[model samples]
Target: MNAAEIARDVSARRVSAAEVTAATLARVQAVDGDVGAYLTLLGEIARSSAARVDERIAAGEHLALAGVPIALKDNMCLEGARTTCASKILEHWIAPYTATAVARLLEAGAIPIGKANCDEFAMGSSCENSALGVTRNPYDLARVPGGSSGGSAAAVAAGEAAIGLGSDTGGSIREPAAFCNLVGFKPTYGRVSRYGLIAFASSLDQIGPLARSVEDAALAYDIMAGYDPMDATSLDRPVERTADSLRADLAGLRVGIVREFDTKALGERSDALYREAYRDLERLGAELVDVSLPTADYGLATYYLIAPAECSSNLARFDGVRYGLRVEGADVRAMYDNTRAAGFGPEVKRRILIGTHALSSGYYDAYYVRAQKARTLIARDFERAFAQCDLIACPAASCPAFVFAAKSDPYSMYLMDYYTIPMSLAGLPALSVPCGWTVPEGGNLPLPIGLQLCAPLFGEKLLLGAAAAYERATNHALAHPAQIGTVPA
Candidate 1:
């Protein structure tokens, strides 16, 4: 069941919250071995949380999530639970407080099943960069579940949890959602609080959910979106209730097809599939119009610079003087160097080096400041595009979930977020919803393709309504893996 169904069943007293959580945990035990979706399982805490929900329901209290099981990306704090961010340096760091988003979900009676695996400090395009373990696509064990939210997507796709809370910097959430055939929603920047979430790129990081259905993603988004005094970056504006406002049709709304993001460039199959998806949307009452983001091609270069510079600054706090892994050295300076060298992965080190160079004495203005200017122009591009359209539609990823070790270099890997980075740079709300299936060459099982729908800042209601309309017209998310997901059929 999706989050809404589980919540309905549990709240109606037809099934207990404890039963739902237990079944979810059991599924994890049976299936996670092959998928490696979880970095840490919270069985005791999950059961306790579910029992509290049951008691509240018995007391006649209404909960939005009401016993729905969730998988938390390891980067989000859960207070006392290990929040590793899939990195070795902080592999055993127990969070001192819960992330506001996680707290909100729990307040709504959502039970956390485990801490999902991710790329080291949410850095990689694929889960391969995780130092501890690898996460496989539930559809094909030999393939990858997209990252840095790979584990979260894997958990949801494998039925171990109803919703997977993931943090998106570039395309962490959406790319993985595309790979795993789930709906991953990245709310507008500041729509959700950043407090208690370990920073990656402070400017671009946004928390959202990966779910099997659009309604479920909207439900989670509504419960988690709001102002937070704890997070200075949190948006103080009134939050719209998107789940309740989801429309059955996209009447009177214009959906933009990015001129720069043409589907034909992705190949004939992708072109045909996405054209069909757009047609499905048009049939559901949306007006399709052409829109262009001239700076879309520059998003990748701008993102790498800005995100890495921010990462370099944020990660400076992880010196040996603080909590987590400590590799002893002859002196204080040596200790810092020793600890970081031992803890951080290859991808993390590469980004840090690039970021440090970008911020260095002779080059700060040359790279860092220039990237900031480019980001402003990118934002302007989106602003102008929104004037012509309500929501933008494009491919979620360049391709379907590829086999493990497919990308040979970092450049090849970085290209995975080609379609997702611009929105992240602009801080707009975007989501990837399953649109169709594709059979890879020599592969029998079909992999999913996603149609990335983006909206102007705080346009959650309009964006979700259109996506929900498209989703209802095409129930692509309902499709399951033929005969895989860590267990025998």
Candidate 2:
């Protein structure tokens, strides 16, 4: 069941929260071994939380997400749960407090089933970077389910959870959603509080949701987004009810099509899928208008500099003096070096080196400062484009999910986020919905393709509503992986 149905059924006393929780847990236990979506399962906490929901239901309280089982990306702190971010550096580190987003989920009566695995410190484009384990795509175990929110997306796609909360910085959530054939929403920066979220790139990281349908994503977003005094970057604006804004008609909405996106950069099949998406939107009453975002071409370059620099600064706190793994050495400097070398994965180390160098004395202006300027240009481009259209349409990625190790080089893997990083750079709201499916050569199962719809800052209601319209017109959201109902023997 979707979160809405679960909440309604639980509130109407048709099914107890405990029963729903048990079923969800059973589903995970039966299939998680093959999917490897979770690093830890909060079975006891889930049951206790479900009991609380039942009690609230009995008292006539209408919780928004009553009894809905959800999975949290390991990067978000849930007090007493191990928030490892799928990195060995903090493998056993337990969070001392819950993230503001998570606190909201609990208040709305959503049960967290476990900490979903992710790329170590949310650094890579594939779950292969995870020190914990590789999370296989449900559609094809040999292929990747995108990253750093791959596990969260996979859990939702495989029906292990009703919804999954993920953090997006440079397409972490959206790319994974595209790969897993699920709906992923990334709110404008500061729209959601980041108080207890483990920082990857502080400015770029935003908490969002991955779900089987657009409405489910919107429902979760509504409950999680709002002003939080605890998070200084949190927007002070009034919270909007996105779920109520869902509509099945586009009518006069003008959707912008990025001219750069229609070029030969995408694969033949992917380009065909993108064209089909344009037709699908037009059929649903949307007016497609050509638009240009010249600066978007530099998004990947700009993000690499800014994100790594921020990550280098934020991750500095994990030094041996504070918490996490600590290795002994001859002196303090040696100890710090030894601990970091042993704790961080290859990708994390590479980024740290690049970031530290970029922020170093002589190169700051050449790298970091220049990147910030490019970021502003990207934002300005969006502002201008939004004036011409209500939302922008593009492919979620250049291609569909690739087989594991398809991108052995880091640079090639970075290009996987080409279609997604621009919006993150602009701090805008973007949603990825399953538009269609494509079967790769020699591949038996069809892989899902995602269509990304982006809106200007604070335009989530419009963004989600349009996605809902497309979803209603074409029931692509109803498609699920063949492995969703089965466990590998």
Question: If scored against the real structure, what TM-score would every candidate get?
Answer: 0.98, 0.98
Candidate 1: clashing residue pairs, number? 0
| Candidate-wise lDDT, in order | 0.92, 0.90
Candidate 2 RMSD to the real structure: 1.7
- What is the lDDT for 411 in model 1? 97
Residues 232-282 of candidate 1 have per-residue lDDT tens digits of 999999998999878899888889999998788888888899999999888
The 10 consecutive residues of candidate 2 with the worst lDDT sum are: 480-489
RMSD of each: 1.5, 1.7
